[model samples]
Target chain A: MRFSEGTHRLHWATAPLRAFVFLIVYFVLLGFPLLLTQTDDGVRLELSAEVAVRFLLVTVPMTAIAVGSGLWAWLALRFRIDGDDLVVETGLLRKRRRSIPISRVQAIDLVRPLVTRVFALAEVRVELAGGEQSEIALRYLGRRSAQQLRAELLARAAGLPGHTPEAPERHLWRVPFGALLGSLVLRLPVLGAALLFFASLVFLVMYAEGGMLAVAVPVLLGLIRAVIAPMVMYANFTVATSPDGIRLRYGLLETRMQTLPPGRVQAVSIVEPMIWKAIGWARVEVTVAGYAGERQALSSTLLPVAPRHVALHLVSQVFPGTHIDAVPLLPASSKAVSVDRADGAGTDDVVFVSRHGWPCRRTDVIAHARAQSVRLTANPLQRLLGLATVHVDAPPGPVQVAASDRDLGEARAIVESTARRAQAARRAGGDPTHWAAR
Target chain B: MAAPPVYRADQAFAPGNGLRWSPNSKRHTWHRLLAAALWAVPVGAVGEFIVWRNGGGPVAAAMWIVAVVLGVVLAGTVAELDRRSLGYAERAEDLIVMHGVFVKRLIVVPYGRMQFVDVTAGLLERWMGIATVRMHTAAAATDATIPGLPAAEAAHLRDRLAQKGEERSMGL
Candidate 1:
């Protein structure tokens, strides 16, 4: 279907612009009448005219500044893609124009708020590999339009293809939800933020706004986000598989839909927060060519929620040679050493509590890192307890699936030993291609 | 017919040619720093002139002028270092960059990965006989640039890289 061809227009996305115009109108019409009113004094107030004129003078420039600023911003973000180049024509006064050839286009990512998503629209980001030049977005397109744009743009970069689609040759693994939420919330600075907001409100009430108003403002905003947190979260995240790429959709206000092909992914990590340990949840992230450490946005996440056991199967599908599901799990009778050292809790025996802690649930889980590079991390207390978290980094990037609190030298050794076996098996013609071979 | 393997200056020709010889690369370090310093001077002059004329005394004027000069000199020096430090690698498929200090990095981004690459020669860069090489990925997340590439080499590299990507992707 033919649709409007472009990013979110400046006039359309700048919501506050109309209000600014209204403010100018309001100041002139209403404030003018108020400022220039004849005083009750018998003498007609001459300054009334002056006051009205001054206000008018101030309003005109303020109005101009508001509208001008938005316009300038729009000018700074003028983007259009031509057959030859993905052109970024941005400037305030100088007219800075940049053209990125389509051949160089590597990936296109989408981002925006759920409101945009609710409208079935999002921002389309254009990226080239190795960081030459790329465009952040061609926004306000409906999902279909955005996808079409992305596909066409990518096809342009891919060049008229006579060759087959060249996605990576492997299935994708998904993480568990319980694990995702646990890690997300645990990492969230909610407590500190709540405390700070509380203090700010108190200060505002006690020192500035006084009493009810100050208290009301902070509490009101806080309560709203608290309520919104789960609701936004519910509609927040979704990841999917597409060709040789992974598509991730996330965000509350700024909804982001990103795609990372296997070629782009540099590393992959799976994190299970304390919360997921109870029900068994996990979150998976990848590292890509352009995207580096910490910001997992560059990579794809397998699952926001899943069962601990099911994780292996999902992983096996996504990343070849990463099939924990195919690998055998050992029971307690097996001689894998306990690596966990929680407080008085020792690795010899793990205490699995059903509930109550921010990660909120508890269970002892240990997965050996796929052996590529050896990494050992220890917290101050873990060190005191003579324990350190160790993971064997795997290629692609390191995959640290599980960790123990204390030093699990023996456990690490055993897992490495098993990893060797897994590696051997992979090398010995375990054709994962059997499942999804092109 | 097998396509003549397309190449960017960074990726074309030399085995270790990619180790440093990027196509179309000249050097932008001096020009950018010069521009910044030139821009800063007028700003500092204005501020100092204002204070001096406003009766803050010659000391304030002198101080402002000194500050502006120092800032420009320091910034220019730093830019020079950055320009001198960069090296490029070119191969048939991709442009490899071994750039940066304190954080020595090797970036091997395939032509397929490049969203687009721009070979630019501004007035000052033109005067210096240099060009800027910039490339992007589809994601638009990380942008890589080789500033101050020799203009002649840059045009050739840009054309070659662009041509290569076009043959493969059908994009600009």
Candidate 2:
């Protein structure tokens, strides 16, 4: 379908779905009192005078207003692709017209929440490179249209002409469900919560008390967030690569497909938690420019959990042709023993890598061309120890590249060398615009 | 004592690299003092009021006097140190900003990575004829600020930096 031809409205399903979502709590609350009226004769449809009045005066009108407004908003909402921008017009009384430049498009994500998924609809979120208010979402598009639109937007952003077929993705890896579950359970918080949960359960059984129930509830909630939520989110997590960039597909209840175009990733970090270290498991995260908002949590995650070698291999793939092992690592100076015992930093022709953190060892890798700035900092204690920290700045995200508590001289050297490397890399860097075209 | 180790002169970020660092305007000192006073006066007044209302007699007044004197002395010293510490240098490919006393920092932001340059002056700063020049890169953590330049200088620096940024524009 030609997106630039004319304006288009959202799917008709949007009206009812939006109304249902808005009144879900109201529906539940109304159903609850009805359920309480159940008896041996079965739930009677007898409504009390007060509830019946409320149903007529409040619930009926509220539902009508919700459905009416949803339908109105749907009617008012119209989006079309202009010459080089996606123009969205919405609202009736207070109209809003937003035109997002295709050139500044960072990443386009397709999200399918459970409700939307049930209706075979999806939400298309377009991320632009700027501050907080940089995301634009077009909700309740048909799943197929959402996918096609995402591909089209990506192709345009990559400076491809016409409706180019998406570059064929080569499957790289998929996180096994068992491994994901195991990894989540092995986490410190999850393990602690599990222990507390069992202890509380034992206490509740040993002595029938309400106090232990409170502890049990919170512990169970923590366990759910730490384990079950991630299990559902990262279920069937898959990674792939193509000429356009890297693609990630994951989620069970709410599916998400994120595409990171070439050269967009500012930095990558490999993390190995203490328990995961024993099992030789690791997680990889990256810092992408323009992902500084709510979507940052999942978008930054390159790999949720994988074997050590797989994580390293993925890192190498993220920044092609660079090998982590090939770069000679320099151990932190002995003078920094007080601050960091087992930490080191290294650099190669293409990337600067720093390994730090005690229980959870994190190795941050920033491509020379991607480095925005380099910093050398020293506190009084560090000054006394003749130690300083060299920090490589990228856009705001999870990946922090810092070589902390190094000898002052080494820190200074790192800063100078990194800056020079960044300058040289910038000179040779590929055109940021029209990435695929180049 | 033995002579200090002679590091390479080409180290751009080295503290003693002989770069011609431009200090903030002299009026910045007064501006900082006034700003500090603006904060301290109200805070100190509230604190003194709380102490007096609690029914402590002359002791509260004496304590406040000591506190005020100590605060002024500390603020004055800090203001001087801060004035001495803040410096920025425009180099061949990047701008370097150095500041802080107890915790010294030197940040080098490449011109090519700068998204924009912002020049701002608060009411107090405008009154004092001083402004701040902030160089923003795509990276939010790039803390490149020249906080106390004369108004004209700040504008000049902002324009020059903006021009350089455009010339060396490397999109993120």
Candidate 3:
């Protein structure tokens, strides 16, 4: 369990589970078409001895290769803690050695895909503060070992002394299944899809048109993917706070536990879809530095659905002393009322908040110190209107903090003030490297 | 609606804030023109070829010539204006880059937020003795690029920005 002492190998189940995952993909890709083939009489293809031999000939070698490579990869991969760095050695012939400094570790996530979960295995992903390639993934570790390794890495990253156990998590909130399903139903896309389905059904009944099948089938598929998929993924959503950071655990088929360390959240946005307003519900999303490109989707969601007030409480907890309601929100310039709503931007000692978007409203909050840059932009039309937009830039993620269509002078003031506040905050900011030492 | 807030030339953070905006080298205009020509020539030839293949009379040929001329003039005018608009200023805590004629944009990136500074020169730029200095921060949205600086100035600016970035380095 002491990860600092010796090199660690993945769980023995890794190879078999990895091979099983590959075989599933191969079957779906290669076998589906063959199974779906029909004769002139529309009877599905039967597995004759020749077909059986062919299938065996193909799959037998594929099984061997998959299992062989999986075992080989498992044999080649070795990781260990060396002083201040976590070194991972991989590759067989053209060897690769990646040594990541503990101080630079942004996050450590434990992911259990469905197949791996069946074997009580999880993948440990270490995200560093850099580009997309900065992540190191150790696939298929024993579930308990994965958790222990995560705790150890996080403790080391937080500058804790040797052998500190994982911090006790204080359960903050859990989304009820009824609320999760209700929230999904209330979504704009789902509601629209439902309406479309009903409309098409009526059309089909009244007109008896075969053409409607084309449209209905795709809509049903989209409904399954967009609505049902998230419903399953966000089931049993729970959030807990600890010294390691905010811990999020959720998923139905494939569970994941993600830790967002202190000072790592670059920006936060509380989103309230129009329909959800009736139920007083909102979703919280955040932007972290390293969760970019493909990983941005599921990882950025802090809370899938929560009551409006609970969401506010979670945001406050994430930012410690900052309270959304306490900040005096200034109205957008009178000139901007026609284009943008009166709700604009506000800033206090710690964070800057900007309210924008419509129907699906978003309130973006960013710590003054976390702002990477400040931008002021105006198109020819905006210039004529004497209005500009101020963008408080953060890392690439869903959270975008911008006050659009503000009076030019006010926009200029925002840019100057935000930059000044950011500079001062950085000067006063605590040392992030030694988070626990502080 | 309210007669638009009085537009001021010297707003605090405006591109025209009376800060000494260091413009790109004038040679950049010629470089841009050459780059434009590299594309225009082939496109013009294709257009002429199509006209000839279609057996269009001298009138069509004349119109094509006029169109090509207008395009070149437009490109030249844009290049000159863009060159004029491209400028940067070194503020106390941040570096400001401003460009664009139609949609003027000014971005202020604090030195502490800069992850790295890159100086790059394309073949055309190298031939024209110019390079570009780009500053990257943790945020990919930070678009801080000052192009068409004299090669030496670009190198000097890169070194200076890198040093400032180091001195103010705060990890994300």
Candidate topping TM-score: 3
Which residue pairs clash in candidate 2? none
lDDT of 3 by residue, B1-172 (tens): 1222333534734554457888999988888888877877888889999999999999998899789878888888899999888789998788998888999888999999999999999999999999989999888889999889999999999999999989999988
Native contact fraction, candidates in order: 0.00, 0.62, 0.66
lDDT by residue for model 1 over B1-172, one digit each (tens)? 2322333323211224224444333246667777987799789978987897789988888888888888888887777666555666666555655454333233444554455678877788888898877876533323357777778877877887788766544111
Which candidate has the highest lDDT of all? Answer: 3
Give the better candidate number (1 or 2) by DockQ: 2
The per-residue C-alpha lDDT of model 2 at residue A171 equals 94
Model 3 off-target regions past 4 Å?
A: A22-66, A337-342, B1-18
How would the candidate models be sorted by DockQ, starting from the highest?
3, 2, 1
List DockQ for all candidates: 0.02, 0.47, 0.48
Recovery fraction of native interface contacts for candidate 2: 0.62
The root-mean-square deviation over C-alpha atoms between each candidate and the true structure, in angstroms, is: 14.7, 4.0, 3.8
Candidate ranking (lDDT, best to worst): 3, 2, 1
Candidate 2: C-alpha lDDT: 0.83
Chain A only: give the TM-score of model 2.
0.91
Model 1 residue runs over 4 Å out of place are: A1-220, A223-229, A232-269, A277-279, A284-302, A324-438, B1-30, B56-60, B101-104, B164-172
Which lDDT values do the candidates have, in the order given? 0.49, 0.83, 0.86
Q: In candidate 1, what are the lDDT values of residues A107-175, reduced to their tens digit?
A: 567766545545566677765534323345564555665666565555444443312333432334433
Weakest 10 consecutive residues, lDDT, candidate 2 chain A? A30-39
